[model samples]
Target: MHVHNSTRQLSLNEELTMSKKLIALCACPMGLAHTFMAAQALEEAAVEAGYEVKIETQGADGIQNRLTAQDIAEATIIIHSVAVTPEDNERFESRDVYEITLQDAIKNAAGIIKEIEEMIASEQQ
Candidate 1:
């Protein structure tokens, strides 16, 4: 029974390690409504697609949920949905990024997630 439990735990750890990590940055000129909304949309879409996502919002209050270096390094893709350019945009300079307008993110986040998944799949092929 102990051996079986250890095997199960190892599988769980493998699953977590194998899951794709996604990071998003959202901002708008006004930096209020659109920024937060787009972040929420992207988070929902990513979760539905089985990705672990972290979102940073550049809004009226300034940056929130800021991304760490570790987060950036582990992420498979970065999504930028902004009306104005985001702060610390250089942090993602070396990463695969998908940039879109705030409107597009709020209205079509699921589509964007699907596109990223396809992009990753193609690269693997």
Candidate 2:
């Protein structure tokens, strides 16, 4: 059943490719509580949704877990949860991006994830 095994392997690969990868930038004007809390909320929501996510926080201390070129290339969407625009905002110029306030991100991270998923689904149709 070599042919059957090959077909199964290809299906698995396709499934992996279809899974969404999200990159997020979180910040706040004060660069304090809201920045870190929103980042954590987004991370938890993404994990629960079975999507891959990377979050970079720009705060008083500066950027942490900075997104790389590879991270940008592989991501399906960019989420910006901030009070002010992030330092390197132009980096996601060509990507599909969703912008939300830090307050919304902190209060309803899961809702944001659901909205993104719905957007992706509609685009595929």
Candidate 3:
């Protein structure tokens, strides 16, 4: 019984330590459709996966919904869906970063999240 209790406690602790937030930086060469579309797709996918998500867009309109230091710190992972280099990328230098194309983010956002989730689970194991 003590062993079972300990195991249960450890599981709970692990779950608590797992982050529930995601931060995405989406950009494109023209700062147009791909940028905003990818951001929207990622946000929707993250939300459907029950994660608190913040998506920053670097487009022709410039950076919108810019992510802050606190957001980066709380995120489980930082995803960059950009054709061009994302701005302020130094902020994610020490983060668990995932890179994907803007089109991929827009078309397969759910798959991207699922893959990340699997990666996280594997790391925990």
Candidate 4:
């Protein structure tokens, strides 16, 4: 675990509390490897780029880490790297959403995150 030299250790919840949130959903037709691989890549990339990630992985079992209404409302960015359309996708109807393939997310998540950072920067200006 990465830690800072501070008087107190921060829990995961505490660390994420002040963060810029990024929400993602990753799925694939088979609901197997690609579904999980892409979600992990995207989450790692987002965290390294200073965003807190809340990811939903859809597979044969079901969705994990499902996003809540509050999570969606607070998200600074939303990405869907999916082969199959997500089950509850309409939650983002009024939000700016980005889509990518599972392969793209797994292979180029750093580049994807950098681009997203730039996009947010330009929009803020």
Candidate 5:
């Protein structure tokens, strides 16, 4: 029974580690309010869903903590919730991209994550 419990725990941990990490870009035309808000929402949702997330925001001022090429390569998916076209689209090229509305990003972040999770599961199957 003890060995069985250990095996189950290890399996759970391995599943969590294998789950994809998502890199997201959230921006708006002005890149002020909506951009950061969406990033925060997505980050929170990813955490709750047990996925790692790295977010980059393009604000009116400039890009903030921009996503690196390495980040893009390592991430399993990309989520773009923006009013304007993302400036750094090249890095996400060939990646699984999810384009969503800013409002939906904020109000339904968890649902969005679940949708992406389901999509990935189906694709893998």
Candidate 6:
């Protein structure tokens, strides 16, 4: 149990170190409620996990605060919670991306954080 706890702590520390200014783009088919909700959820989760994150939302008004290539390049990971086609894939380029549903983004935010952290850790390995 001690070893497991230590490993978990180490993982969190590693994630914090690697998290530096993460950026994410969120959008949905209608761009009404789901997009905003997902963005909020992801931001909250990232904060809780010790990551500094900025999220962009694509809504009826069109892309708001659209993430730049620089933001994508600096992000440790990107999460897409759109129900339909996501238009921000190109921004991420070769960075780690997690494509998921808005419901999952809201209900499983911690899991999403864990998934991203694991990806970063695995990539380092």
Best candidate, TM-score:
3
Q: Where does the lowest 10-residue lDDT sum fall in candidate 5?
A: 1-10
Residue lDDT tens for model 2, 1-125: 00001111224455477557888999998899999999999999988888799999999899999999788767766788988978987777656668888888888999988887787678557
Q: Tens digit of lDDT per residue, candidate 1, span 1-125?
A: 00001111224455467558889999999898999999999999989888899999999999999999889777766788888877888887666678888888899999988877786578556
lDDT of 1 at 42: 93
**TM-score, per-candidate, Cα-based:** 0.83, 0.83, 0.85, 0.82, 0.82, 0.77
lDDT of 6 by residue, 1-125 (tens): 00001121235555566546657677887899889988988899889888788888888889898888767655666677777766645555465567777898878887877877776577568
lDDT by residue for model 4 (4-122), tens:
11133345575466468899989999898999999999999999888888999999889889988788767777888999889888776666677888998999998987787787578
Q: Write the per-residue lDDT of candidate 5 for residues 21-93, one digit (tens) a residue.
A: 8888899998889999999999999988887889999998898879997786566667888889889676665
How many clashes show up in model 4? 0
Q: How far is 74's C-alpha from truth in model 2 (Å)?
A: 0.6
Superposed Cα deviation of residue 20, candidate 4 (Å): 0.9
Q: lDDT by residue for model 3 over 66-102, one digit each (tens)?
A: 9998897677767888888878888876566788888
Tell me the whole-model lDDT of each prediction, alpha carbons only.
Answer: 0.80, 0.79, 0.81, 0.80, 0.78, 0.72
RMSD (CA, Å), candidate 4 to true, equals 10.0
Q: What overall lDDT, based on C-alpha atoms, would model 1 receive against the true structure? A: 0.80
Off by over 4 Å in 5: 1-19
Candidate ranking (lDDT, best to worst): 3, 4, 1, 2, 5, 6
The segments of candidate 4 whose C-alpha lies over 4 angstroms from its true place after superposition are 1-18
